[model samples]
Target: MKNEPVRSEAVGISEEILRKWEAKGVSRRDFIKFCTTMTATLALPLTFAPKIAAALEDKRLPVIWVEYQSCSGDSEAFLRANQPTAAEIILDIISLEYAEVVMAAAGHQAEKSKWDAMEKYKGKYLLIVEGSIPTGEGGVYCTVGGESAVESAKKLIKNAAATITVGTCASYGGLPAAAPNPTTAVGVRDLVPGATIVNLPGCPVNADNLTATLVHFLTFGKLPAVDAIGRPKFAYGKRIHDNCERRAHFDAGQYAESFDDAGHRQGHCLYKLGCKGPEAFHNCPTIRYNEGLSWPVMAGHGCIGCASPGFWDTMSPFYRRLPQVPGFGVEATADKIGLGLVGATAAAFAVHGVASAFRKGDAMESDKVKVEE
Candidate 1:
């Protein structure tokens, strides 16, 4: 077994940092509330709020974010995060030692900074890989500092405490591995099979999940409990359909057959249009994107199941039902439909039990919360 991190608050927030943030219009109260929100997101006891506060204040943990075969969408999502805001993320959370897209330094300087940080933080820093690794042609498809993506990841991840695969690309090869998969793109787990990796998959992952996972790591000094695919169970435990806002409509058999139809305008369930929520596990419905404003389904689009396995291929034919899933099959009996709905309803109730642990909480307290436009 690996040795656990010895917890301490020695590196917590300093007065100077607080003063700097205060000048930026963030009051101490707002800061505490944000910490409380992070605590909520982690489903940690309220008592742990102060602990999270202390950890963020400490800011001793270093992170190295690398992009491989990707569109940099995940990095953009991280920067656009609204719940706590990206500025707050950079100033208050983990020390981002190196990132290819964001760092000011480039060329040899950027490469030096990364290697230096890795050497300095060895076996302690968190490694975040934001894209898939292309193994084709000696991994010549994607290179940084003259090193292939596979080579770079292998070098860095080996010395890190834990790894986080931030987007569908990094998690499961995403679009890069779709169809013929010319690049032979594969996820971080496949490339570094021995490393402990937490996959947060989506076209561009929800930033809140990234924040919560980081908090969990800081709080426990270890990785959070994960599903079979190495997704944190706290975040990926429930099927999106189970907690969808249109679930009542689905239960009542009010489905929209087309985007232009009256049912869609009426906010009917998107099952008929091939919503993949039933088979997908993610908190998009509850977490929503852009500071809890709205999600794809809420916007009248069927879930493409971006967070599910092999989504690019398996969840395709975007506007049609998947061939025939087990419970929601074409030949399913009436009893099966009733049982499925009943189970979905029951799962809906249980979702809160887990959701409350880490959800950003405004919704937990009030239904009056409006989506940010």
Candidate 2:
């Protein structure tokens, strides 16, 4: 268990010059405003806001965010974060010197940028890992500049003040990590021993969580408090179902039976259809998606539970509640069971009818009783 970092070094931020001004660069007032926002995001003391401003002025911390085994969805998601126009946010916050996606440079030039950032900001920058690392074939599954992503991340994370693992693909093995896990993908924690890792688990983790974590780190010079699994409690503390709007319908035992069923029209709970909100942790319901517009459940789809550990495997039966759905064979189907049962019942009825006819003949022929009787 490594200890938390104390505030920025005393002489570091408040050096000889109080303010630095460049006509083309960010203004002092703009600096203070960003700092204040950082303070509010972290819920820190007002007094510390100035410290944040001073630190940015004193030193521009480099941030290197790595990608692996991902569709670059994490990058797409961060680009789509609800606030801050994504572009301005990245450009304004920490000196994002090496992201291949957004950096102006390309090919060999892009590679050089990363090397420069690593050299200049060693032991000071932040490292954010966005996907899983392949441990197979010496980590050859994914590479940048001919070096394995694992190797690249290892070099970057070693000197970083802290590392943030965002999205389920980075936090756990994710979909690419399903069963065969061809490349044996692993998370940052597995590769970077003893480094402080803050895991934010989700398909595309709530962007606000990422921003909030960054703000907390900047304001306090330490990773925010984390839960046992290295996830920040603020976002991952509660079960989605606990705060979901459909929870009331769940408690009332109203459920959507099928795609266009009556219950569905009424917007009932989707647990019967394999919603994993009760088992997964996230702020999806609270924060929603598309800048607080709506989430899966709110959009009428059951939560696929992309945030929970091994969700692609464990909480499956994608539309059923049963944990281990019976798999008779690959060719099995519900219609098969219904037809099989119906056939057996019909056979049994036929046999019973024959037996009754042979044994008694209704007991009327032998007695020759009156027609009415």
Among all candidates shown, the one with the greatest lDDT: 1
lDDT of 1 by residue, 1-373 (tens): 0122322233233445445546656765556556666766666666776566656655657999999999999999999987678777776677899988788999999999999999999999999999889999999999998999989999999999999999999998999998799999999999988688899998899999998898888877888887777787667777777789998887676878788999999999887687877767778887788878899999999898787667577666567643223333223222224224323432443454323422444333342211111
Flag regions of model 2 displaced more than 4 Å.
1-60, 322-373
In model 1, how many backbone clashes occur?
10
Clashes within 3 Å, all models in order: 10, 0
Residues forming the 10-long window of minimal summed lDDT in candidate 1: 1-10
Lowest summed lDDT window (length 10), candidate 2: 322-331
| Per-residue lDDT value at 76 in model 1 | 97
Computed on alpha carbons, the lDDT of every model, listed in order, comes to 0.76, 0.68
- Candidate 2 residues 1-373, lDDT tens each? 0123323233233322224522325444444444554565455566676576555444455798777788778788888974545765676556787776677788889888887888888888888888888999998899989999988888888877788988988887788787788999887888886787898878888787788787677656888887666777667766666788997787666888786899888989886676766556677887677767898899999887787666476555467542211223323222233223223322433555433522433423543211110
